[model samples]
Target: MRRPSGRVMVGAAVVTVVLLVAAAGGAAWWRWDTQRQPRVDDVVTDMNTAVADAVAAAGEDAAVAVSPVVAAADCRLGPLRPGKIFTGKADLYTDPGGEDALITTIERNLPPRYAAGRGTAVAGVRPLQADIGTVTLSVRRLSPGWLAVTARSRCSLGAATEPAAPTGAAPGITAVTQLLAAAGTRPAGITEQRLRCTTGDIVTISAVSERTDTGDLTDRLAPALPSTARRFTTGDANRISYRDGPVSVIVASSDDGTAITAQHTTGC
Candidate 1:
């Protein structure tokens, strides 16, 4: 067998280095494309913008870019009717910090309102934990416009809560999450808990407890609530009101007994 010369060895080494460099460059470009936020126009443009911003702000490895729930939505925001809904969802690779990191990134990037110039409306984040927890946000358009962002999600996310003014808003998004955990039989027991801090502060805790009879679901959850809270019964809805510093907490239950909600309103 003939031995290779020095020239052949040198050429092979140089080719190997070039291949490695190309691989690295390709990886970087893929990350940028996957994480870059999406842009839109008119109706609910801010909605798409907000979700995209939140995912990019997350600083995590997201698998895909922001995508419209409706394909045509890419052209412009849709559902130009009152109470019409538009949704967008993006998935993120989990970070070492767990849910806290995801929640913080979302709250930070998530917009408080659709857009200042669009009109007068509010936006809020409500976090829900099922097999895998999710956060959902809703935007209500106060005036007739071309855009309305109904819901958006990052990670394992979902939404449920009424829109409220940002007056005397809760301390932070973290506090709102803490409140939800404190007022439940179990975090998993509450299927949906939404927190909105925009023009106003609102937190809604919804519980569908298997431990209690459907007829007395509210009765079961009321006792588990913070002792400082004053419980009020409005027909079938169980409303629990409490104050922590400037934030006023109201926990309510649906009359049907399937859901219990907590709202930290803007005012007492």
Candidate 2:
């Protein structure tokens, strides 16, 4: 009888020791898991602040104050190539106003693009949680201060979708288009203002204002072109040459017209 009782006591002691070891192992793992994640408070705060600034800048007549609440925050951290991505829901509260109008106002106020240090911010407003709108925001890293080019969808694996290759046109063509959008058609007299991109090892961009003062056009456009590039002038012809990544662009112009050429190959 004494021996059996002794054996039972030893069995209980062994079981207790096993349980203690398991608990300690679990605690260690929990600590490691928590440490692996990034500190996200700063990111969340910046996003919230962006929303507030947008609202304040709107200055709508039907003014309504908005408050944002972030929920279900999930973030993925990586090294260099592409940076971090943070996704969550942004809930907005506004003073009593029609939902549609409030939504429209908020959308109008939101920044077209928020530079999140090479990250993308995708916040979609939807009528969720009892007719109040909620925005699911996604911030993905691009380079150092811009959003990712490829948008995030529910099915994406967090990899940046490769951008489609250009149609072999000089990049300057796009720059000229944007400039035109801002400068608009030359003041009345300039009838034949033109821009052309000829692609090759050296992409050439030509801007001509027929029968118009090239000086006026150059003055208007020179301000629009990159000021950091090395600038040169010859008589009526002004030239700004610079390297944009692997491509070298030389923009030459006069009061009559302008020509921009870019090259990526050796010599010529």
Candidate 3:
């Protein structure tokens, strides 16, 4: 995660303590700064808006997968803090070299006052942190070729929300279909996520599912792939990644078998 914003300092920390108290006691603090302090719902809404702004700046087709509002955690905007926020995943429409291209686009085209590079201390992807007034957005490479955007809201007071179903158009299912056919065992659950592109014409899709049969997933699925497909070796996970088809397909089962996820992600 990224560091806290240093603007308000002591005053913001004091306000955070009050909000945390209100979260526990249902106090009337909500009425004190109805405009300045965002409620939990307000934070989630602002996060979504920031994601949209980023997408528009990139001007690419993408898909979204959002989670419920997570309860109080360390507030990155102030000290001695707790923050409530939701995280969503989205794709940036791209071709080969798209991730870097999209990054360049965001750095050059989006509003400069809000966005800056490499915000989070998180180890994986080097994110572009954008502080768009109400929320902070982190956009970075989700995988080797996928650009995903994640937004974290500032400290707030209010009841958290359950994840709501997002609406968007579906992307091509060819890669996912190829995956399921070779998976051998049926998925315990299947879910589809989509994010509309800035152009409003297309979307990126992610079809995800879990599998219980922890068998030799790689052996069973590898032989089915064409000679053109390449395999990657990640630690412990029995899996393969090949993006030469209609979309990118990744079938990975945990070393113990309970963590398998068959995912369809947009590829460059």
Candidate 4:
């Protein structure tokens, strides 16, 4: 066999080195992607189990509780879209006999941040847990006697994605309409209402209570509003109230149906 020349040997060696480096780089990228893929199923399962366990331990009358740390984990590691999050509410029928004990158990076991979200005044807490891209848990009591537990999972998606548009009618008119419907009344007095869509494309509706106001309708209805509708406020005169509720919000994409929340108002 002919002996290989020095220049030819050097060139072959260079090519081989380049190939090895390329292969190594590809392998590293693949490993990173595999690791980064959110473990949605596992996280969700864990969240479900945690919630169930908390509820079971606390018993039927127990109020709900949530953990902020768990929520952060669910948001950072779960499978939901980045920046998107999950939230839930549970209604618990209060049994007079078990109410006190249940509330005690929830207050002792559930996390504090969650309790605050549910409005501590309400008695009986419900537990909530989630694992998507994020997790959040909270508990609260409702007026007219009901307990609520909520959980949220945040998405990892960044700010670039445009938020979804408002779904129902404009907030000022539609929110009032929804409140009336919930309160079992007819829409009246609302006119020339306009809504502004902000950062999250959030829609806010504000109006002054009309002369026909019969009760503290706005205050009564605020709590009942959907979770998407947040940061509620009343006007200076107490004659006007406003609700900054979502015109459109994202929930889990499931076969059952999309979950929607509406702002509830009584006066104005």
lDDT of 1 by residue, 204-250 (tens): 32233333223343454455556654332334324334443333444
How do the candidates rank by TM-score, highest first?
Answer: 3, 4, 1, 2
TM-score of each: 0.30, 0.28, 0.53, 0.31
Candidate 2, position 131, lDDT: 12
Model 2 lDDT tens row, 1-268:
4466888989999999999999999889767755654444434444334444333322322211122222322333433122334333212222223333344444454455442222122232232111111223332222111111111112111332222223455454555444443334322111111111122122223333223333333465566555544332322334333333332333334423542221111111
Model 3 stretches astray by more than 4 angstroms: 1-36, 52-83, 90-114, 118-127, 140-148, 159-178, 201-211, 214-250, 254-256, 265-268
What are the Cα lDDT values of the candidates? 0.37, 0.33, 0.54, 0.38
* Candidate 1 weakest ten by summed lDDT: 139-148
Candidate number of the best lDDT: 3
lDDT of 2: 0.33
What TM-score number comes out for model 1?
A: 0.30
For residues 43-87, could you state the per-residue lDDT of candidate 3 as single tens digits? 665665556557557643232232333563645334533455545
Candidate 2 matches the true fold with a TM-score of 0.28
Off by over 4 Å in 4: 1-31, 62-83, 87-89, 95-101, 109-136, 154-268
How many steric clashes between backbone atoms does each model show?
A: 20, 17, 3, 29
Lowest-lDDT window of 10 residues in candidate 4? 193-202
Q: By how many angstroms RMSD does model 2 differ from the true structure? A: 19.3
**Model 1 segments more than 4 A misplaced:** 39-149, 152-199, 212-268
